[model samples]
Target: MCTQPAQTEEHDVSTQEENLSETDTALKSIIADVLGLEAATVNEFTPETGLFGHLPELDSMAVAGLLTEMEDRLGFIIEDDDVDGEMLETYGGLLEFAHTKRVEA
Candidate 1:
Protein backbone atom coordinates (compact mmCIF):
# COMPACT_ATOMS: atom_id res chain seq x y z
CA MET A 1 0.00 0.00 0.00
CA CYS A 2 2.82 2.40 0.79
CA THR A 3 4.56 1.70 -2.51
CA GLN A 4 1.31 2.09 -4.39
CA PRO A 5 0.68 5.51 -2.90
CA ALA A 6 4.23 6.59 -3.64
CA GLN A 7 3.88 5.45 -7.23
CA THR A 8 0.66 7.36 -7.60
CA GLU A 9 2.25 10.48 -6.21
CA GLU A 10 5.17 10.16 -8.58
CA HIS A 11 2.83 9.73 -11.48
CA ASP A 12 0.94 12.86 -10.55
CA VAL A 13 4.14 14.89 -10.41
CA SER A 14 5.28 13.48 -13.73
CA THR A 15 1.97 14.36 -15.32
CA GLN A 16 2.17 17.91 -14.04
CA GLU A 17 5.68 18.30 -15.41
CA GLU A 18 4.53 16.97 -18.78
CA ASN A 19 1.70 19.46 -18.84
CA LEU A 20 4.11 22.28 -18.05
CA SER A 21 6.39 21.19 -20.86
CA GLU A 22 3.50 21.20 -23.29
CA THR A 23 2.50 24.68 -22.20
CA ASP A 24 6.06 25.90 -22.63
CA THR A 25 6.27 24.53 -26.14
CA ALA A 26 2.92 25.99 -27.07
CA LEU A 27 3.90 29.41 -25.72
CA LYS A 28 7.17 29.46 -27.63
CA SER A 29 5.30 28.66 -30.81
CA ILE A 30 2.80 31.42 -30.20
CA ILE A 31 5.51 34.00 -29.63
CA ALA A 32 7.40 32.93 -32.70
CA ASP A 33 4.33 32.97 -34.88
CA VAL A 34 3.03 36.26 -33.59
CA LEU A 35 6.34 38.05 -34.01
CA GLY A 36 7.35 36.40 -37.28
CA LEU A 37 10.44 34.98 -35.62
CA GLU A 38 12.19 31.79 -36.55
CA ALA A 39 11.33 28.76 -34.47
CA ALA A 40 15.01 28.23 -33.71
CA THR A 41 15.28 31.74 -32.35
CA VAL A 42 12.33 31.27 -30.05
CA ASN A 43 13.50 27.84 -29.01
CA GLU A 44 16.76 29.34 -27.80
CA PHE A 45 14.91 31.39 -25.20
CA THR A 46 15.73 30.51 -21.63
CA PRO A 47 13.67 31.18 -18.53
CA GLU A 48 15.72 34.28 -17.77
CA THR A 49 15.54 35.55 -21.33
CA GLY A 50 14.02 38.99 -21.39
CA LEU A 51 10.87 39.73 -23.33
CA PHE A 52 8.67 42.83 -23.76
CA GLY A 53 11.14 45.71 -23.60
CA HIS A 54 14.01 43.40 -24.45
CA LEU A 55 12.64 42.01 -27.66
CA PRO A 56 12.68 44.47 -30.51
CA GLU A 57 9.94 42.59 -32.26
CA LEU A 58 7.55 42.56 -29.33
CA ASP A 59 6.41 46.13 -29.32
CA SER A 60 3.09 47.52 -28.07
CA MET A 61 1.26 46.64 -31.28
CA ALA A 62 2.80 43.17 -31.35
CA VAL A 63 1.71 42.61 -27.77
CA ALA A 64 -1.94 42.82 -28.74
CA GLY A 65 -1.53 40.30 -31.51
CA LEU A 66 0.57 38.07 -29.29
CA LEU A 67 -2.04 38.01 -26.55
CA THR A 68 -4.78 37.29 -29.06
CA GLU A 69 -2.82 34.38 -30.50
CA MET A 70 -2.08 33.10 -27.01
CA GLU A 71 -5.80 33.12 -26.24
CA ASP A 72 -6.74 31.37 -29.47
CA ARG A 73 -4.00 28.77 -29.30
CA LEU A 74 -4.04 28.14 -25.57
CA GLY A 75 -7.82 28.16 -25.26
CA PHE A 76 -7.78 30.66 -22.43
CA ILE A 77 -9.32 34.12 -22.20
CA ILE A 78 -7.00 36.90 -21.04
CA GLU A 79 -8.91 39.92 -19.86
CA ASP A 80 -7.56 43.44 -20.04
CA ASP A 81 -7.10 43.41 -16.30
CA ASP A 82 -4.67 40.54 -16.64
CA VAL A 83 -2.37 42.60 -18.80
CA ASP A 84 0.71 43.40 -16.75
CA GLY A 85 4.39 43.99 -17.36
CA GLU A 86 5.58 41.29 -14.98
CA MET A 87 3.83 38.63 -16.97
CA LEU A 88 5.85 39.65 -20.02
CA GLU A 89 9.10 40.43 -18.33
CA THR A 90 10.81 37.10 -18.92
CA TYR A 91 10.29 33.82 -20.72
CA GLY A 92 9.69 32.01 -17.43
CA GLY A 93 7.13 34.57 -16.36
CA LEU A 94 5.12 34.10 -19.54
CA LEU A 95 5.37 30.32 -19.28
CA GLU A 96 4.15 30.34 -15.71
CA PHE A 97 1.22 32.61 -16.55
CA ALA A 98 0.21 30.48 -19.49
CA HIS A 99 0.56 27.27 -17.50
CA THR A 100 -1.52 28.66 -14.70
CA LYS A 101 -4.19 29.82 -17.11
CA ARG A 102 -4.14 26.48 -18.90
CA VAL A 103 -4.55 24.54 -15.68
CA GLU A 104 -7.39 26.82 -14.66
CA ALA A 105 -9.07 26.29 -18.00
Candidate 2:
Protein backbone atom coordinates (compact mmCIF):
# COMPACT_ATOMS: atom_id res chain seq x y z
CA MET A 1 0.00 0.00 0.00
CA CYS A 2 1.16 3.51 -0.80
CA THR A 3 1.13 6.08 1.97
CA GLN A 4 0.21 9.68 1.41
CA PRO A 5 2.57 12.44 2.62
CA ALA A 6 1.35 14.70 5.36
CA GLN A 7 0.12 18.04 4.20
CA THR A 8 1.50 21.19 5.74
CA GLU A 9 -0.46 24.28 6.71
CA GLU A 10 0.67 27.70 5.63
CA HIS A 11 -0.22 31.22 6.72
CA ASP A 12 -2.00 33.61 4.34
CA VAL A 13 -0.44 36.87 5.26
CA SER A 14 0.03 39.49 2.56
CA THR A 15 3.43 40.26 1.04
CA GLN A 16 3.45 43.59 2.86
CA GLU A 17 2.85 41.87 6.15
CA GLU A 18 5.58 39.34 5.48
CA ASN A 19 8.06 42.05 4.63
CA LEU A 20 7.04 43.94 7.75
CA SER A 21 7.51 40.83 9.84
CA GLU A 22 11.02 40.31 8.49
CA THR A 23 11.94 43.91 9.15
CA ASP A 24 10.39 43.71 12.61
CA THR A 25 12.44 40.66 13.48
CA ALA A 26 15.65 42.35 12.50
CA LEU A 27 14.67 45.51 14.38
CA LYS A 28 13.76 43.49 17.45
CA SER A 29 17.09 41.70 17.45
CA ILE A 30 18.95 44.96 17.14
CA ILE A 31 16.93 46.52 19.94
CA ALA A 32 17.59 43.59 22.23
CA ASP A 33 21.29 43.64 21.48
CA VAL A 34 21.72 47.38 21.80
CA LEU A 35 19.67 47.82 24.96
CA GLY A 36 20.77 44.57 26.54
CA LEU A 37 17.15 44.13 27.58
CA GLU A 38 16.21 41.15 29.69
CA ALA A 39 12.72 40.76 28.27
CA ALA A 40 13.85 37.44 26.76
CA THR A 41 13.14 38.99 23.36
CA VAL A 42 11.78 42.07 21.63
CA ASN A 43 8.24 40.74 21.77
CA GLU A 44 8.34 41.17 25.53
CA PHE A 45 7.87 44.88 25.05
CA THR A 46 4.54 45.69 23.57
CA PRO A 47 3.38 48.91 21.93
CA GLU A 48 1.83 49.98 25.18
CA THR A 49 5.07 49.87 27.13
CA GLY A 50 7.06 53.02 26.70
CA LEU A 51 10.44 51.73 25.64
CA PHE A 52 12.38 54.76 26.80
CA GLY A 53 10.68 54.82 30.17
CA HIS A 54 9.86 51.17 30.80
CA LEU A 55 13.17 49.85 29.53
CA PRO A 56 15.86 51.11 31.84
CA GLU A 57 18.52 50.21 29.29
CA LEU A 58 16.88 52.53 26.78
CA ASP A 59 18.15 55.87 27.88
CA SER A 60 19.32 58.65 25.55
CA MET A 61 22.61 57.00 24.75
CA ALA A 62 20.99 53.68 24.14
CA VAL A 63 18.42 55.30 21.87
CA ALA A 64 21.18 56.95 19.87
CA GLY A 65 23.04 53.67 19.60
CA LEU A 66 19.91 51.86 18.53
CA LEU A 67 19.14 54.52 15.93
CA THR A 68 22.62 54.30 14.48
CA GLU A 69 22.45 50.54 14.36
CA MET A 70 19.05 50.73 12.68
CA GLU A 71 20.40 53.12 10.05
CA ASP A 72 23.23 50.79 9.18
CA ARG A 73 21.13 47.66 9.28
CA LEU A 74 18.14 48.97 7.27
CA GLY A 75 20.29 50.79 4.71
CA PHE A 76 18.15 53.95 4.85
CA ILE A 77 18.17 57.44 6.22
CA ILE A 78 16.46 58.46 9.44
CA GLU A 79 14.97 61.92 9.36
CA ASP A 80 14.42 64.31 12.26
CA ASP A 81 10.65 63.78 12.11
CA ASP A 82 11.26 60.10 12.60
CA VAL A 83 12.73 60.77 16.04
CA ASP A 84 9.39 61.27 17.68
CA GLY A 85 8.69 58.99 20.60
CA GLU A 86 5.42 58.08 18.89
CA MET A 87 7.32 56.36 16.10
CA LEU A 88 8.79 54.05 18.72
CA GLU A 89 5.84 53.89 21.07
CA THR A 90 5.67 50.15 20.50
CA TYR A 91 7.18 47.32 18.51
CA GLY A 92 4.22 47.40 16.18
CA GLY A 93 4.66 51.08 15.49
CA LEU A 94 8.34 50.65 14.81
CA LEU A 95 7.66 47.78 12.50
CA GLU A 96 5.05 49.81 10.67
CA PHE A 97 7.43 52.71 10.26
CA ALA A 98 10.21 50.44 9.10
CA HIS A 99 7.93 48.85 6.54
CA THR A 100 6.83 52.22 5.28
CA LYS A 101 10.41 53.37 5.00
CA ARG A 102 11.40 50.16 3.27
CA VAL A 103 8.75 50.72 0.65
CA GLU A 104 9.71 54.35 0.26
CA ALA A 105 13.35 53.40 -0.21
Candidate 3:
Protein backbone atom coordinates (compact mmCIF):
# COMPACT_ATOMS: atom_id res chain seq x y z
CA MET A 1 0.00 0.00 0.00
CA CYS A 2 2.81 2.41 0.84
CA THR A 3 4.58 1.70 -2.44
CA GLN A 4 1.37 2.19 -4.38
CA PRO A 5 0.85 5.61 -2.84
CA ALA A 6 4.40 6.63 -3.68
CA GLN A 7 3.92 5.55 -7.29
CA THR A 8 0.75 7.55 -7.53
CA GLU A 9 2.52 10.61 -6.12
CA GLU A 10 5.31 10.22 -8.63
CA HIS A 11 2.84 9.96 -11.47
CA ASP A 12 1.13 13.12 -10.31
CA VAL A 13 4.41 15.00 -10.22
CA SER A 14 5.30 13.77 -13.68
CA THR A 15 1.96 14.83 -15.06
CA GLN A 16 2.34 18.29 -13.52
CA GLU A 17 5.78 18.66 -15.03
CA GLU A 18 4.46 17.68 -18.44
CA ASN A 19 1.68 20.22 -18.17
CA LEU A 20 4.16 22.95 -17.25
CA SER A 21 6.33 22.04 -20.20
CA GLU A 22 3.39 22.20 -22.57
CA THR A 23 2.41 25.56 -21.12
CA ASP A 24 5.90 26.89 -21.62
CA THR A 25 5.95 25.73 -25.20
CA ALA A 26 2.57 27.23 -25.91
CA LEU A 27 3.63 30.53 -24.34
CA LYS A 28 6.80 30.68 -26.37
CA SER A 29 4.88 30.07 -29.54
CA ILE A 30 2.39 32.76 -28.65
CA ILE A 31 5.08 35.28 -27.89
CA ALA A 32 6.92 34.51 -31.07
CA ASP A 33 3.82 34.66 -33.23
CA VAL A 34 2.64 37.89 -31.62
CA LEU A 35 6.00 39.60 -31.91
CA GLY A 36 6.72 38.28 -35.40
CA LEU A 37 9.76 36.40 -34.19
CA GLU A 38 11.03 33.10 -35.40
CA ALA A 39 9.91 30.08 -33.41
CA ALA A 40 13.54 28.98 -33.31
CA THR A 41 14.53 32.19 -31.59
CA VAL A 42 11.85 31.80 -28.95
CA ASN A 43 12.79 28.14 -28.45
CA GLU A 44 16.29 29.23 -27.46
CA PHE A 45 14.95 31.24 -24.55
CA THR A 46 15.95 30.24 -21.04
CA PRO A 47 14.60 31.28 -17.67
CA GLU A 48 16.97 34.25 -17.59
CA THR A 49 16.13 35.42 -21.13
CA GLY A 50 15.40 39.12 -21.03
CA LEU A 51 12.13 40.27 -22.62
CA PHE A 52 10.80 43.77 -22.03
CA GLY A 53 13.75 46.14 -22.35
CA HIS A 54 15.96 43.77 -24.25
CA LEU A 55 13.59 42.69 -27.00
CA PRO A 56 12.98 45.50 -29.43
CA GLU A 57 9.79 43.77 -30.54
CA LEU A 58 8.39 44.03 -27.04
CA ASP A 59 8.12 47.79 -26.92
CA SER A 60 5.23 49.77 -25.38
CA MET A 61 3.16 49.63 -28.55
CA ALA A 62 3.49 45.89 -28.70
CA VAL A 63 2.66 45.13 -25.09
CA ALA A 64 -1.09 45.36 -25.56
CA GLY A 65 -1.01 43.18 -28.63
CA LEU A 66 1.16 40.63 -26.84
CA LEU A 67 -1.14 40.49 -23.83
CA THR A 68 -4.16 40.17 -26.05
CA GLU A 69 -2.52 37.34 -27.92
CA MET A 70 -1.56 35.68 -24.67
CA GLU A 71 -5.14 35.87 -23.45
CA ASP A 72 -6.47 34.49 -26.68
CA ARG A 73 -3.97 31.67 -26.82
CA LEU A 74 -4.11 30.74 -23.12
CA GLY A 75 -7.87 31.18 -22.74
CA PHE A 76 -7.46 33.48 -19.72
CA ILE A 77 -8.50 37.02 -19.00
CA ILE A 78 -5.87 39.56 -18.05
CA GLU A 79 -6.91 42.67 -16.26
CA ASP A 80 -5.48 46.09 -17.03
CA ASP A 81 -3.49 46.30 -13.83
CA ASP A 82 -2.06 42.84 -14.34
CA VAL A 83 0.06 44.30 -17.12
CA ASP A 84 3.29 45.07 -15.31
CA GLY A 85 6.90 45.34 -16.35
CA GLU A 86 8.18 42.68 -13.99
CA MET A 87 5.73 40.14 -15.31
CA LEU A 88 7.46 40.37 -18.70
CA GLU A 89 10.99 40.93 -17.43
CA THR A 90 12.20 37.37 -18.09
CA TYR A 91 11.07 34.20 -19.74
CA GLY A 92 10.60 32.53 -16.36
CA GLY A 93 8.46 35.34 -15.03
CA LEU A 94 6.14 35.16 -18.00
CA LEU A 95 5.95 31.39 -17.73
CA GLU A 96 5.18 31.62 -14.03
CA PHE A 97 2.53 34.23 -14.62
CA ALA A 98 0.91 32.15 -17.36
CA HIS A 99 0.98 29.06 -15.17
CA THR A 100 -0.66 30.97 -12.34
CA LYS A 101 -3.37 32.21 -14.66
CA ARG A 102 -3.90 28.73 -16.03
CA VAL A 103 -4.26 27.34 -12.51
CA GLU A 104 -6.66 30.08 -11.50
CA ALA A 105 -8.80 29.45 -14.53
Number of the top lDDT candidate: 1
Report the poorest 10 consecutive residues by lDDT, candidate 3.
1-10
Superposition TM-score, candidate 2 onto the true structure:
0.74
Q: Candidate 3: where are CA atoms >4 Å away?
A: 1-11
Q: What is candidate 3's local distance difference test score?
A: 0.85
Please provide, for model 2 over 1-105, each residue's C-alpha lDDT reduced to its tens digit, 9 standing for 90 to 100: 234344421332355578777787788888878877654766676656566666677888888888888889987788888888777666667777777787677
Report, for every candidate in turn, its global Cα lDDT versus the true structure: 0.88, 0.73, 0.85
Q: Which regions of candidate 1 are displaced past 4 Å?
A: 1-8
- The sequence of per-residue lDDT tens digits that candidate 3 reaches over residues 2-105 is 23466588886787688789889999998888778899988999999999998888878787788888889888999978778889899999899888787667
- With candidate 1 superimposed using the best TM-score fit, by how many Å does residue 8's alpha carbon deviate from the native? 4.6
Model 2 spans with C-alpha error above 4 angstroms: 1-13, 38-40
* CA error at residue 1 for candidate 3, angstroms: 29
Error of 1 at 3 (Å): 21
lDDT of 1 by residue, 4-97 (tens): 4665888877887999999999999988887788999999999999999998888898999888888998899998888899999999998999
